[model samples]
Target: MPNTGTPPLPDTPDNWPVPPPPRQEPDQPEPRPGPNPGPETPDDGVPDVDGPADLPPNPPRVA
Candidate 1:
């Protein structure tokens, strides 16, 4: 209980200490078109995966 050594890792990666520039306008505006309705789009007879089992090609507009 008399040896704590363990703290040294800074040779590259941009000096390291850049964490103060992240506030690009996002207080309440910019969420009127991004919720769910993203995956699961297999209609039109269903058949789009391709290979081994085939069935993967119905991506023209998911959501």
Candidate 2:
């Protein structure tokens, strides 16, 4: 059997083909206002795992 060798890489990264651009989104409609209760409600005093005390002042809001 004859010897086989690996293919050589391009001289520079620029020689690589660029990836396709990200998908575009259509214009979105204005957001509607959410519900609002008439009067101020009292808190139930339940502990929040990721609330003010638990998280840093400028905590990241990730999904």
Candidate 3:
């Protein structure tokens, strides 16, 4: 006959070390706008030289 030893008992939850709670960072303030801010409008201050109508018609395709 073979003799087998009993297995070790599992660790209890109470014996385990408790970890500390996570720290929270304070909210940061947004940066103020610089003196030379970009133009609000898409065109800025430049005038449009040529309109769509001013362009010449497309030449016929050479098929």
C-alpha lDDT values of all predictions: 0.59, 0.58, 0.56
Instruction: List, in order, the clash count of every candidate structure.
Output: 7, 0, 0
Predicted candidate 3 versus true structure: per-residue lDDT over 5-46, tens digit per residue: 866557988767797878766588667765653444344344
> Candidates 1 and 2: which is better by lDDT?
1
Candidate 2 residue lDDT tens string, 6-35: 666768988788999998876997688766
Candidate 2: misplaced stretches above 4 Å? Answer: 1-6, 30-35, 38-63
Best-to-worst ranking by TM-score: 2, 3, 1
lDDT tens digits by residue: candidate 1, 9-45: 7787786777898768967877575455455555545
TM-score of 1: 0.21
Assess every candidate by TM-score.
Answer: 0.21, 0.28, 0.25
Predictions ranked by lDDT, top down? 1, 2, 3
Pairs that clash in candidate 2:
none
Q: Give candidate 3's error at residue 38 in angstroms.
A: 12
